[model samples]
Target chain A: MEELKQAILNKGVVVSNGVLKVDTFLNHQIDPILIAQMGQEFVKRFNGKEITKILTIESSGIAPAFTTALELGIPFVFARKKKSLTLSSNLLSAKVHSFTKNETNEITVSKDFILEDDKILIIDDFLANGEAALGLASLVEQANATVVGIGIVIEKSFQPGREKLEQAGYQVESLARLASLENNTVRFLEEVATK
Target chain B: MEELKQAILNKGVVVSNGVLKVDTFLNHQIDPILIAQMGQEFVKRFNGKEITKILTIESSGIAPAFTTALELGIPFVFARKKKSLTLSSNLLSAKVHSFTKNETNEITVSKDFILEDDKILIIDDFLANGEAALGLASLVEQANATVVGIGIVIEKSFQPGREKLEQAGYQVESLARLASLENNTVRFLEEVATK
Candidate 1:
């Protein structure tokens, strides 16, 4: 988590409106080594939760989820952002609104992927509005699976996403929490010490 | 490779239009152990290439690419399927036509990610017509980088993707080469022996 905070300070850029972009190493251009480290951190944070499956969204969320799943030796099911020709089948779906894209789209997971007894660990790259993570949790409940906990790479503490998930009675843990981005200077909620 | 073939033969379902759906293990619901095995196989097939980076498309391609990158100790950059609100400037863009979705979309990569001296290895989940591979190659060229090779998990050898890349003078390697999918039965060109 300290490494993550340092990486955000050194490489992250906020374009406008408190939107922190760590795509340099987090989303678009991935550093799998750092991702593996974050996976270790997530594993330590949610220790002994007995995570059976990892649930993530398509595109950005796959990186950390894949690394964590590999470290945990578990399979991951990524919900499709859109029901394409290949994914037109029985699915558990929920609508999610993206504040960045300003659009609402239905995210779906195949019905065969998640069974009733599976324990799901939901991970995401960014947890801004919590729509994507909640959408994944929606599918988790639809499948009658137990929610272990939600692991987030970066969370905007100024936003209401953590509050929303907490109100919904889900355990949420983020590696890096950004307190503010006032004047393009990113500040961390908790001061992270270097190792 | 034998494990991949067995996974295909046992769990892969050949849907209509000769589309072999291995979403059960390869893409949608990903098996991390099998993916790790395939990554080691990639490390073997692409031996001594001195690949500096791995390039792949978004969503489905990230799983195998993640494992392969982690195995090879190289970073990977996934080309964004669409230009998002966060990724708005300084991008190397190329238009690609998707046969599955029947539409053309511009795939963009951040200009800051790739360098002129970077040697890239492009990997993908499936190769039918090679649009995604070619699109990634376009981005590699735009960065003034050298492409070491193209690696595919399943190449529909009946299609023209391999031929097209070979004609383009690219070293294209595939783990499992499907001969055909006649009568809803998937057959591999190279009959992989189980390990």
Candidate 2:
């Protein structure tokens, strides 16, 4: 987490009060070395949990989830933002609203992938309003699967995403927590002593 | 690459005459262990190339590219299909037509990521008509970067993707090459005797 925090401070661009652009290394362009470390950290944090699969949203979430799944030796499934023609009709879906894009898109996964007895760990790149995370959880629930926990790369602690997932009775682990992004500066949340 | 070929023959589904769905382990639902091997294979295939970075499109391409970059110890960049609010105006864009979706999307990468003197290796999940690969090449060319070669996880040899890229003078390496998908069966193209 120190490396990630340092990377955020050094390379992360604070575009505005709530927006932090990590395109230089995190999302748009990726640093595989750093990402692999993050994955190891997630595996360590979620140690001893019975995780049958890793679930994530498409695009940004794929990298961290893939690495974590690689470390855990489990398969990871990415929910597609749009249903493609190749996708089968048997799907588990939920409507997710993106606060940044200000649009609602239906994210879906094939029902065949998530089985009834499976334990799913939800992972994503950023968690702001918890819409994407909650949507992923819904998909798992639809298939009668167990929600193991949620793993996040970067969490906007100023936002309600963490609180919402915690309120839903799911454990949330974030590598880098942003306390604030005000005045074109980056601030990280101090680690809670209990965690 | 025998493991990949066996995976395709065993789990790959022929949805139709032209479409072979490996969603079970390749794209929708991903097997990290296998993908890591695919990444290793890519590194072995493109060995000795001066690859400073890995370039790929978003979503499915991110996994293979991420693993390949991890193995090569280089940074990888994925072009965004749609411009988000957080993206800067300084961008390099290219139009890519998805034959499967029957749609064209303008993929963009941040100007800060791709440098003029950088040597890049393009990685993708599948190669069909070569549109996506060519689109990525154009982005590299826009930045005046040198493309080392293109690495594809699966290639439909019957399609024009490899031929087009080869004719365009880019070395194309595909781990699994499909000869045909007729009568709901998967057939791999025989390996060329010479490298």
Candidate 3:
């Protein structure tokens, strides 16, 4: 978590009205070593839980989720943002609103992938409004699967995302929680433990 | 390779007018063990190649590419299907047509990721028409980077994708090559080598 905070502090940029960009290593281009560590941390946090499958959204969450699932030796299923021509038949879906893109897209999962009685952990890059996490939970619910916990790489604690999920009775854990992005600087909610 | 061919034969279904659905293990719900094996194989084939980076398209390409990059101890950059609000001003862009989705989308990559002297290896889940690989190669060209090779998990040899990439003079390697799927049954181009 400290390293993640450092990465954000050293490389993250604030632009276009408080938007934090860490794509250089977190999103567009990935540092597998750092990502693998993040995955290990997630597994460490959920140490005793029997997670059958790891779940995430397409595009961004796939890498971290894949790494986490790899560490757990479990399979991962990512909800597709759009229904492709090759994907068909029965599907469990939910509408997700992306504040950045300023648009809402119907996210779906093939019903065949998620099975009832499977314990799933949801992972993502950032939790802004918690809409994406909630959407993923909906898909798991449709499958009659249990939502064990939600793991996030970065959480904008000032936003309503964390509170929203907690209100929905879901346990959420994030590696880096930003207390505020005020004055063009990142503030962590808690002190980062330095080695 | 034999395991990959076996996976396709066991879990793959030809649906929606000859579309092979390996979502159970390959695309939607990924079998991490199998994917990691595929990644290791990529490293095995491209041994001694000085690959600075692994390039892939978003969504499907991220998993295999990440694993390949992990095996090679290098970073990977995935081309975004569209421009995000957080993406930068200067970018390398290309127009890509998705036969599966029946649409064209402009994929962009941050110019900061790929370097001119970098030797990039493009990796993807499937090679059918080869349009995605070509588009990714175009991005590398814009960066003045060299594409050392193309790694594909599965190649539909009956299609023009493998031919197109080979014609373009790029070394392409695939774990499984389907000679034909014309009869709703997969026929391997060559007998998978059993270790």
lDDT pick, better of 2 and 3: 2
Candidate 2: deviation at residue A144, Å? 0.9
Candidate 3 lDDT, B62-163, residue by residue in tens: 999998988888889999999887775889999989887789989899999989999999999989999999999999999999999999998988789988
Candidate 1 lDDT, tens digit per residue, A1-195? 878888888888877656878887888888888999998988998998989999999888888888888889999989988887778888899999998889898999998988999999999998888999899999999999989999999999999999999999999999999888777788788863321
Per-candidate TM-scores read 0.96, 0.96, 0.96
Across A1-195, the per-residue lDDT of candidate 2 in tens digits comes to: 999988888888888889988887888889999999999999998999999999999889999999999999999999999988888599889999999889999999999999999999999999999999999999999999999999999999999999999999999999999888877778788953111
lDDT by residue (tens digit), candidate 1, B5-95: 8899889888864688888898799998899888888889999888998999988888888889999988899998888877789999999
Quote model 2's TM-score: 0.96
The 10 consecutive residues of candidate 2 chain B with the worst lDDT sum are: B186-195
Tell me how far the alpha carbon of residue B163 in candidate 3 is from the true structure, in angstroms, after superposition: 1.4
Ordered from best to worst DockQ, the candidate numbers read 2, 3, 1
DockQ, each predicted model: 0.83, 0.88, 0.84
- Off by more than 4 A, model 3: A192-195, B16-18, B192-195
Interface RMSD of each: 1.0, 0.7, 0.9
- Residue pairs with backbone overlap in model 2: none
Candidate 2 regions with alpha-carbon error over 4 angstroms: A191-195, B191-195
Model 3, span A1-195: residue lDDT tens: 877888888888766334688887778998888888899999998899889999999988998999999999999999999887677668999999999788999999998878998999999999999999999999999999999999999998888999999999999999999877776777788964221
